[model samples]
Target: MAEEWRRETGGRRTSAARERFERIYHTLRDRICLLDYPPDTRLSEEALAEEFGISRTPLRRVLGLLEAQGLLKSVQGVGTIVTDVDLDELAQVYQLRMELAELLGKLSPVMPDEETLALFRAHHKRSLGLIDKPDPRTFARLNMDFLQALLLITGNEPLRDISERLYFQTTRIWLKLTAHMDIAEEVAVFSREIGDILAAVEIGDLEAAGYIRRSHISMSFTRLKKLTI
Candidate 1:
């Protein structure tokens, strides 16, 4: 009985640790994606550990995960630095994302519940507001939220994981380049995408929704390429 109790306690501890790790990892990754920690921004390990109330060991693990995701890199003398995205890398990743977006429907697609559809409707409404008051940061966050809600409709774990990683990997590019691009136009296009995706999902057409996302991704990449050139 004592041995069983110890095993259960260990399992709980492991779960808690995992939860903590994920929380920290996501927070840091979001900051990177949002450009709060822009390209080449050096992250202080000690400061982050103090901020999260965690030790260096676990914090290092979180940093390691971000590094693996192409969001951060460790320098020999410098600490973990947020990596920059160039047009070439963006092109490659965007191509992969376009391909995977369609797979969201074909591979184990899960029809979203009404509540999920409602959330998408909320995204559409929020996107409409951006057409007039186009705020890049707010739009970036909305994009993240919409992506999360969309991923929930797919049961393929690998697809979801790669889709999200590639998303954050390329998301910062848009925000970073907003100065040179047409904010209103981009927002308008994105708003249309949300509406179309929401409409597709509303009628129980997961495959159509995936195709819609793919089309937008391709168009978005073309726009981005023009700007980069």
Candidate 2:
């Protein structure tokens, strides 16, 4: 009876451990995205565990998961540190995002259903509502959500995977650049532009949709460059 009870307790502990790992992993990822854990900052597992009130085992598991996701790196003697922003990588990601976003616009006209349009409208509204909130972090997340919803219309698995990865990296950089820049007007303008793009797609004007999408991304890049200094 004691042996059986011990096995049951072990199983419960394993399940709880997995939950704790996921919780820590997502919290760390959010912090990284928001630039709370700035570039090249050393991350102490023990301190994190203590702060989160979790054990080392779960924290270690979370660290390994983050490392695999390219958000953290562990050196032989330097411990785990948040990875620095790579300009080259950021450029590549921005280029890829532009391409994929244009492709998504091209495909939007052929979605052949109202559900896709409805999703786009919903996200666009939410993004527009966030324009006056004065929080860069919230604005960034809503912007990303709007873009992801637009891309989901394509239903291309590989494209979705690539876009998500690129989106996260671009969002990280964007959040950093906008930390001190108040561009609420620009965000509101872009929100209106997105609505126009969706309207064009609904009318089956693929070429117009593509042009507007590309223009929006290009303008955003130009604006971001001006603020990075």
Candidate 3:
């Protein structure tokens, strides 16, 4: 009985620690995406561990996860730095993202429960209100939230995970891109495309949602085509 109790205790502790690690990873990841931790920003393991009050073991695990996601790079003696966005790499990423997201559309029920439906509707209204704001960051973040809300209703872990990973890669890019954009033009474009997708979702029509998403993505790629990057 004592041996079994010890095993259970250890298991619970491990689970709790894993949850904490994930939370930290997400915190750092979101900051990076929001450009709160901008490109090439160096962070030492010791400093981060101390800041978070976590020991090296758990903190290292969080860093490792970020590195694997291409968000951070660990240098031999210099510690880790947030990776810069590569437009070429981003284009390749989107190719894969498009394919994976289509898989999600096929697998996802998109029939969100009433509570989720209500939540999504609220988020949609919120985005519309924010559309007039001049800050591209606001629009970018809201776009992320709206997409996340849609993915939440998908209930497919692999799809959700890949979608988030790819999305993060482009968040900082969006930040940069927004600076060069006519906010009014971009916001209008996003509003129309996103509004169409959300409307389809609101009615439980994943087919139309997927088509709208595809077209929206194609439009975005075309917009980027003129860039010398």
Candidate 4:
């Protein structure tokens, strides 16, 4: 589809390359989010292009997208480096997230469709099973999936777009702290919070659902603060 779009647009020099660039872009973005490529890590355009079997031209395009997302920066004398989170900004962003989450909860369908509920239940069971599984990455992925699925119940494009941006922007923060996070404790908290919120939604108690969601977000920030300076 990307190739077809590019071809139809008839862009010279770059039409045939959009698909490859997009794939590479998402791969690097996920690595950045998961800390597979840690902050302050230097990204060499030449090395990356070679690694991905692409050329510098398309590689720069991918890097540009990551930079625009605030995940990468080009430095003089050094190479492109992963951008570090500003502490104050992190606090403010997460604070805003609390309210945004509340609003989303209030706005989401009071009774989500059967598919949505089933997905939530699957995530719930998976989250419970991971509590003592000794794999932080797996659990974190499941938690992310659960939250994302729940957020989809809102069916608000603008809201989902903004919320998702904030989500990925801060996701690295949580992923970075997995080393210090208590897996069992984190799992238990997430399970209870998700359970309560879903229960409220099932009963059409949007107000209670919203409150529970806000409180859940607040608790996350509180825990993150404790680990931060």
Summarize candidate 2's per-residue lDDT along 148-175 as a digit string, tens digits: 6666556555565566656666677777
TM-score of model 1 (CA atoms): 0.93
* Superposed Cα RMSD, model 4: 4.6
Best by TM-score: 1
The list of candidate 4 runs beyond 4 A from truth reads 1-23, 50-54, 106-111, 203-210
lDDT of each: 0.87, 0.70, 0.73, 0.74
Better of 1 and 3 by lDDT: 1
- All candidates' TM-scores? 0.93, 0.70, 0.87, 0.79
Name every residue pair that clashes in candidate 1: none
Q: What's the residue-level lDDT of 146 in candidate 2?
A: 72
- TM-score-best of 1 and 4: 1
Q: Which tens-of-lDDT digit does each residue in 42-152 have in candidate 4?
A: 988888989998789878877876786688999989989998776778878887777877777556444677887777778778777776674767766776687677676
Each model's Cα RMSD: 5.3, 7.8, 5.4, 4.6
Residue-by-residue lDDT tens digits, candidate 1, 34-127: 9999899999999999999999998987787778778899999887899998666887899999999999988998988888988999999999
- Model 3, runs deviating above 4 Å: 1-15, 108-110
Please give the RMSD of candidate 1 to the true structure: 5.3
Worst 10 residues of 4 by lDDT: 1-10
